[model samples]
Every structure is written in C-alpha cells, then in structure tokens.
Target: MTETVQRPTLEAVAARAGVSRATVSRVVNGGDGVREPLVERVRRAVEELGYVPNQAARSLVTKRHDAIAVVVAEPETRVFADPFFALQLRGISKELTAHDNQLVLLLTEGRDDHARVGRYLAGGHVDGALVFSLHLDDPLPGLIQRAGVPTVFGGRPGWSDGTSGVVYVDSDNRGGAREAVRHLVGLGRTRIAHITGALDQTSAVDRLDGFRDVMADVDPRLIAEGDFTPAGGERAMRELLDRCPGLDAVFAANDLTAAGALRVLREHGRRVPEDVAVVGFDDMLPVAEQTDPPLTTVRQDIEEMGRLMARLLLRGLDRLHPDEGHDPAVGAPASVVTPTTLVRRASA
Candidate 1:
C-alpha cells in the first residue's frame, strides 16, 4: 500500500504555526501586518507543508491580467508572407515573454475587422496595445489612445493625427532612396525611369519624393507607380518602356518591383546594365542576390526596428504615466526614426 499523503490547508498551517487563520492568510498573501518572528513561523510551516497559494484567489484581488495586444493592420497573407513582419513579431513576442506579459496579435484590415479590433483593445481585454503598419486616416490608433490606455506605434504614418504622440520606431527611407537614385545618376544613367511603391504609405511617398527631388533637373515623366507587387512592377515597367523606350535605367522602389521589371526587360531583349540598369530597395538578401544580375539596393535594419519598437513599448509600460505619478520621466511618449544605408552591387 502507498503511504497516505496529506494536503496543506490555511487552518492546518495556522494551527502548526500557533497563529490565527487571519494571520496565516496575511502571511500567505504576502501582507506585512505580522511581526518578524511570526512571519518566520508561518514560512517554516508553509515549507514543511508544501503549500501553493491558489492563483484564482490571488488574481481576484489584484485585477491584473498581465497581458498585451499587438495589432497589425494588414492582410493575413501579407502577415504570413512578409519576412519583415515576421521579424517584428518575434521581437515583440520575445520582449513580452521576458517581462512576463502575454501577447495577442490582431490583424485589422476590413471595416468589420476594424470594429472587432476596436472592441478588443478598448474593451479592457488587454492592459496595453502596440499597433503597426498603420496608414494615413487609419482610425484604429485614435480609438485606443482615447480609451486612456498606453499605446505605442511600430512606425510613423507621417501626417496622421494624434498617433504622432505615440512612441514609435522607424527606419530612414528618404535618405536611403536619395542615395540609391544619386548612385544611379552618377553611373551616367540619365533617362532613368522609376517604378514606385504604394503612394499612400510614407515609405513609398518619401522614396518617390526623394527620387523626384534628386531628378528635378531631369524630366518628371520617368516615374510610374507600382503597387509593390511583381505584377504591378511589370505593368509599370511596360508602361514606362512604352512611354519612354529610350530610358537607359530604372530605380525601382523595392526588390520585387525591380525583379519584375528585370523579367519584362529581359523578355524585350534589354540587357542588364548594358541596356537598362536596375537597382532595388530593401536590400532583402535572397531577392537582391539571386537576380540574373544581382540587385543593388538600400540596406535597412528590419529586425532591429521590430526589437526597438517592443523595447520602447516595454519602457512605457514599466511605470505609470504623468497622470498616475509625479515623475516627469514618464510625461510624454516618444517617436524614433532610424537611419538607412546604401548597399552597392552589380546591377546598378
């Protein structure tokens, strides 16, 4: 027969420690009412009995769920496919774990989806929220901010309202784009056509503006917008070629666009560099390096951006805000803009 085992209880511990049930309860709950010797007696009894406090009982008093939400306003396909998004997700997940906080990821795209996301954040479902991939006129951020909850941004949606005050982390796109274009110009690639990304995004718009500002002395007809898809880039490239066949080079807004242009240009018997020079952005290694002619592009810290955004949010969550405390250190949220660099390769 197995040895009879005994379970620990508050009354048993109090009896063994020569203390009242109330005193034992205080000790178990980590309260500070009892004197030192009595506290030691309670601890001894607890150790001997192997008592584990009931979590359900404890949480009822604290009212802290110790969880957070991460909202990415993009499609499920985009979230699953994009490496940059993956990096950010990992960073946010790691930081939340290190701080013992749970994370919930929400993808809010459609109008109905947007309504669900609003309730999830504003409903007191999570203690705080971190939102990313926000666009101009995106009302999700404003809704959560008005709820009086601590919110943080993954990037600045540039010209957006109220979200500007939210702490964020972003990479430098304007300078990097200018450098890529200037490099192309230096290589005697005038009549250089550009395939732009989505204009509503600041990254896309800023890159386009940088390209235009650099080429202001040149003709403006050389630019065409692509939706950052290979097909979009191919269409944009064909249109550019049809309008400006004499175009000697192209600076695409991203690697995917550049790759698409390459396919079309090759089909049209245009040689790389020798016929139509090409450069891509994002310096995404596999896409940049695998091209028939490797793509020259701009390098950005995609993973670091994710990690920094999480860190920024964690710091903000560490202590109460100005309204909750007297410390000036917690007054206003912050916005951080990271710098960009150019990585030269054979294609340009």
Candidate 2:
C-alpha cells in the first residue's frame, strides 16, 4: 500500500512562521488581537506548508461552527419556478463562501416542517440563520427566537407584536409602489387600479399601503387581491376588467402577476400603454423583459439584499465573539430598507 501523506499541523505552521502555537491558533481563528505583521507571517506560513486547520477541533476550542443556516419557507414548486429565490441564494452563497462558512439550507413546506426547522436550529447545528419568505402569523419567527440563534430576516416580517428588536432587510416596497402609481398618474391615467399580492405577506401589505398613499380616494372596486402568482394575477385582472372596464392603469404587486395581467389585457383587446399603462414590482428579468411590450417596473436589488442579510448575520456572529474584534455597534440596526428605482420600458 502507498504511504499516507501527513498533513501539516498547527505546530508546523508555528515553526514555519517563527511564532508560538497559541499565536498561530489565534491567527488561524480570526487574527484578533494579533498585529498585522504577525498575521501576514502566519498566513504566508500556512500557504507554504499547506496547513489546513481541523475545523472540528477548532470548533471545540472556539465554540463556533462557521456555518450559517438559510431557511426558505415557501412551496417547493414556487422555489423552483421563481428566479427571485435563485438570485438571492446566489448572493447569500457568494458572501458565505468568501467568509469560509458553510451554508445549511432548510426548506419549510408547512407547519410540520416549521417544527423540524425549529428543532434543527435549536440543536446548535449552525452559528446563525437567514430566514426568508415569512408570512403573517408564521411560527418560524417565534421558534427562531426560542432557539436563541442570531437571525436576520430577508423581508419585513408581519408580526402583530412590534418587531422593535428584530433585525431584517427589505426593499422600499412602499416607496417603489408609490413611484409606479405616480408614474401612471403622470401619464394622465385617471382610472387607475391596483393589483395587490397576498395580503398575508408584509411586502404585499407595504405595496398596498404605497398604492393607497398615492391614490388616497381610489375606488374600492378597483382593488383586486392576487396571490403573487401568474394564475392569481390573471384571475384578478379578469375580475377588474369586468368591474371597471374604464380603468386605464394598473400597478401589479410583482412582475409575475404583471405578466399574467398583461396576457389577459391582450386577450381583451387592450393595447398596453395606449389603452392601459401597466407597472410591476420586482423587475424580475424573465417575466418583465419577455412580456410582449417589455415592462416598466420597480427594481429592487434582490441579490444585494441577500448579500446584506448574510453580511449582517455574520457581523452579529462576530459581535457575539467579542474576542474576535467585532464591533458591538454593528448590531445596532433593527432593520435595513434598501432603496428601489423604476425601470421604464415599453409596457408603461
């Protein structure tokens, strides 16, 4: 049998770098409290010796797993069908990979899965969590709280009690929706309508608030509820046209919904922008650009939001390990609202 090649140990790295084993360990962990010059020396020695620290042993000493859990609470079909989650996952994965942390994905389909997720998080399998797609009355938030794991939400959570201390990242849904409505109004469209997403979601709720902000006296008959799906959008659009044939503008809560509405509008002989100006949120590439006349929509940096969520969670983890030199002030923000911009295209 061939001889097994021995791996370089911490002692070997220390000898190569001309530092004590403890110093090497400290540098390997995070280099907190170690001078810059020593850090470089240790890094160079690690490279030269191909010294890879034993993560299991290191965790035993530092009590950190260097792993993050990403919990996506949505239907499995929706997760696969929508590009939004894929883009966000790309951003989260990139940031976590850069920090040498493992990503543990937890997909929750329903109530039963929520309990399993709670148990896993409480089991101490990860250092922190990034949760997404939370609906109103979601039990995961309370479960996460009970687990005592540091977590950052992907969107504004809808909890009856105040989310005073809860940390989250979300787009300016209200502002974006307002802009979309105001743009339609600028085009002199008086009979404007709003297609709302599932009211149970905070993003959807915020968008509706923005619509109401712009159209304070909007006709109650002009509002239709959709489930943020193409099918829902199609049904809502049909219902709106039957109720208000004179409507000239519509602001869909999301791009997929907008695309569905566009299809129905075409079938009903409505010329986009000429007969009915349409605007959508999310600016999802697949639906927005592929629509017959393209689409004018609100653009939220979905990927950046995902990246920020990961970064915030990592920072929170660092703060917990004060010895790692992380600033406590990093955890001061209770929520971060990313800005949104309108992208003009043929649809509007």
TM-score of every candidate relative to the true structure: 0.79, 0.87
Clashing pairs in 1: none
Measured by C-alpha RMSD in angstroms, how accurate is candidate 1? 5.6
Error of 2 at 196 (Å): 1.0
- lDDT tens per residue, model 2, 166-283: 8898999999999999999999999999999989899999999999999999999999999888998999999999999999999999998999999999999999989999999999
Candidate 2 regions off by >4 Å?
1-6, 11-20, 23-49, 160-163, 319-331
Candidates' lDDT values, in order? Answer: 0.78, 0.89
TM-score of 2: 0.87
What lDDT does model 1 reach? Answer: 0.78
Q: By TM-score, how accurate is candidate 1?
A: 0.79
Candidate 1: 10-residue stretch with minimal lDDT: 319-328
